[model samples]
Target: MSTAQRTAPAGADRTKHRKPPARRRPHRDQRWPASVFLSPWLIGVVALTLVPMAVSLYLSFTDYDLFSAPRWVGLRNYTDMLTEDPRFWRSVGTTVLYVVVAVPLKLGLALGVAMLLRSLVRGRAFYRSAFYAPSLLGASMSIALVWRALFNDGGSVTAVLDAVGLPADGWIGDPDLAVYVVVLLTVWQFGAPMVIFLAGLQQIPSTLYEAAAIDGAGRWRQFVSITVPMLSPVVFFNLVLEIINSFQVFTPAFVISGGNGGPADSTLFYTLYLYERGFTASHMGYAAAMAWLLLLAVGALTLILFRTARSWVFYADEEGR
Candidate 1:
């Protein structure tokens, strides 16, 4: 064979033995299937939530009633709320009282109910549903109406008191008792926290209980030493949410008090007061200022709780931080 022919065949063999270059994978942005799936949620976030939040923030600085043009008032509204408004301070006091009293009571009842439900062997689902029904109905207009009727003078609650030979006054109308009724309403909606506690209870391992039992730990001891520590995270969660909800309470106070805050303005919650100012009294600018103040109050309280939680909350995972 000629040298040229031999060399040509060897080159062809080497070329054939070499592997082709690897094809590049598509870029992440080019993956249209995932983006198509997420498009609806993205649209909702931008259009419904983000836009409204931005608009509300902007409106909070202006004196805009529903019908009138928005006049920029700057910090005058804020100053009026803090310095010139007496009702603002009164409403703030009422809200602080409600939140401080209601949140702990609600969470305590929730934890107790959850522990009871966790221990029961039969018909657990039935009890859970029954307990949760009130929470589902909470904040409903119907429930508020029912509350008004129930606590009104000569209503069913009063009649029951009469049957038991106890004096019953206008619970919803009397200033002293009106706020208590609101607090009771908050406590009645303990079902959400109870459900969360139930989930937390189920997550605790049975071996811990068994070990406690082997050590002759009583039920109460096992609960305090084991259940509570394990459940601290859930407790913290319920506490934060309850505090936020209690501070934001409005419907019961509004409906039960006939939107006037009723009987010396005792049930004048912060939001209800803001509503009265903005919509009823036409103090839109001042009300907007109150709304921002409330937002700040809630945010500050939540931040404080989160900061304090490090001392109390126990996480099973080492990487919880």
Candidate 2:
């Protein structure tokens, strides 16, 4: 045999070594079960969420009063909403104001309570559960009713205000201050965010505080320099959540205002107004337009917050600021 022939595999061995092209059918077959498992969720999204949103979008451009056929009028709803509806503007303003006032108050109270709970040497569980109890009610009608009962004119809250020597002129009905009652109720339910803040605070390293103390930093300085930076990401999270919830505030306004946006429309949150337009007045198309507008506004605000977070929010795992 030639040296080359000997160095290479014999013909029979070469035939045995030659492999067939890899089969992909088994891998493709393996994906079928995952697709099958995901089908229900995909079906639900399509049937429940996407379908309703699509119908709402289409309805937003038409005049559908729940009885007559939808009359297509391109951009009329949008144009009228922007140019003609005074109530739309009022609702927009009130919702924006509520978000601005309620979100910060809720976050501040929650963070403060969280820090307090963190420092407690005992009864942490009891304090956490007690503080979080109100949030467990969520936006239930009962909670709203209770809030109205407590804060209405001559109610317990008003009585307390009077005890403090603060003048009260129709607490829940005051056009100028009706919204603030809702804001107060929101602040009272700070438990959810407080729990989240407590969890975040727990993750912070104690060594950082010890080091700051060693460097001659006082409690306030340590908190500002170390605690705030480490806890910033949690703050951003609570901020976005509270802003969205504040804009959608309705049950409290509805129950408190007797299904009318509070006296003079001061508590006409965007969602409440949308509900009235759609269901009470049967202006479903207009309501749909308003709904889309609210969605866009929230999305814009959330986007702005996310952009703003780039400068302030910190993460332990991040390699760069």
Candidate 3:
């Protein structure tokens, strides 16, 4: 090789072996702005939520009467609730009944209404707004007051029954019927789930139905094979939410039953019972224990649903699996 070419090649080899410059990481000072911006949320979470949660947990194991300093009593509160308290189990049973009955009925009604809305051709917006109006209004004190008036003896409902030549008892007065009134109230406020289901139903492709029709599938067959399977995820979501909400149901029963859980304490839900124990009876520790138990129950039920969902909930992306 020529000396010039050899020299150029040697210079290239030296240049190839040279290290590149190192990249500079952002300074800690640069991250300060983001940290400052997040401080409010972090402070709120710690002060408002986490602290209260920890206090509640601590109070659950102690004998607290709100007026006096808490005395640590360990499992005594839980033991009494499980063994000595008949009202505890009664409240639990009432809550279980409400959750089991109300969740399915509300979800089914919501899904049905959603499907009906999805199939509508005209005045869809008006109907959607009208149907959802009840849910917005149902939880209000005004609506609860209205519910009380409607179901009370000698009220409009009773008058209607009398006009129809049918016997009517006080729905809110009868222990047997009080829970049913709450259930009816729950069913009437099905608008939120209906709106959610309507959104989910809209996401389903109409082409699936068209293809099923092409394959000679009838309406029922298409619904069973396509609609149910496709909408199972949304149904599961709504079911879980409804289960949680139903377990926490308090307002309607509280307002309609006059906060006494009246008619033999039949309308007394778990939350209402907790409120009575904590505030009225001043059994703060026992109420806290009840609250924790309720949390555990709700958590367990949610876990069970997640476990059960594996068998039936069909993810659109799971077809390959």
Candidate 4:
């Protein structure tokens, strides 16, 4: 055979041994579809939330009535609020008292009812619905109106108390008692948290209870050891949520007090006070400062909850924080 022909056959064999190139898949912009789907929420957060927040923060430092141009005031609004504003401090004190009193009472009632529901064997759904009904209308203006009427002078609550020979006068009028009336209103709407606690209860392992029973532990013992540790995470979650909700309470105070936060501003919650300053009195700059302070207060409380959660909140699958 000729040398050229031999070399050609060898080269052809080498070519046959080589692998073909891999094909590349075309890149699709998956993010665009997600962005399209998320556009509505993004627009709402920016337009209704972010823009307003930025504008308010800027206005907090300036004297901006609704009609006039914003005049720079530096830290005057904040300084005045901290020192010159008595109602500001009163509102703060009232809000703190409300949050402290209402949150624990609400959570306690909710947990107690949840435990009862967990034990009940019949008509559970009906009872759950009945209990949760109040939560549905809890924050509504209609419910606030109804509650006001129920507690008003010579109203149903007052009439009942009078018939029973107890002093039920001026629930919505007494400075000492008006705030408690609103607090009771909040506590009555415990169904939402009850439902949440019920869910958390169901998630706990029944086997643990069985084991505890076998170990001679009583129902109370099991609840203290097994139930509390297991349910701590849920309790913490509900605590944080209820705290936030309690701070933002408005409609009940507004409608109950006739939009004046009245009976001598006794029902003057922080948000109600903020609204009065901003719209009613046209102290827009001062109101803006109050709003920011509220934001900070809520943020601080939430942060504290998170920080302290490590001590109590537990997770089964992971190490405690």
Q: What would the per-residue lDDT of candidate 2 be over residues 52-133, giving only the tens digit for each residue?
A: 9999999999998999999898889999989998988998898788778888888999999999999998999899999999
Model 1 CA deviation exceeding 4 Å by range: 1-26, 29-40, 66-68, 162-167, 319-321
Off-target runs (Cα >4 Å) in candidate 3 are 1-30, 162-167
Weakest 10 consecutive residues of candidate 2 by summed lDDT: 19-28
Candidate 3 worst ten-residue window by lDDT: 19-28
Candidate 2 C-alpha error for residue 116, in Å: 0.8
Cand. 4 Cα-lDDT: 0.88
> Clashing pairs in model 1?
none
Q: Per-residue lDDT tens digits of candidate 1, residues 3-103? A: 88854553422454563323122333446977899999999999998887677667778888877888897777888778887888889888899988988
Angstrom error at residue 118, model 1: 1.3
- Each prediction's total of clashing residue pairs, residues at least 3 apart in sequence or on different chains, is 0, 0, 0, 0
Q: Who wins the lDDT comparison? A: 4
Error of 2 at 157 (Å): 1.7
Q: What are the RMSDs of all candidates, in order?
A: 10.6, 8.9, 9.3, 10.9
Tens digits of lDDT, candidate 3, 242-286: 898889888998987788888898988899999999999998998
Residue-level lDDT for 147 in candidate 2? 83
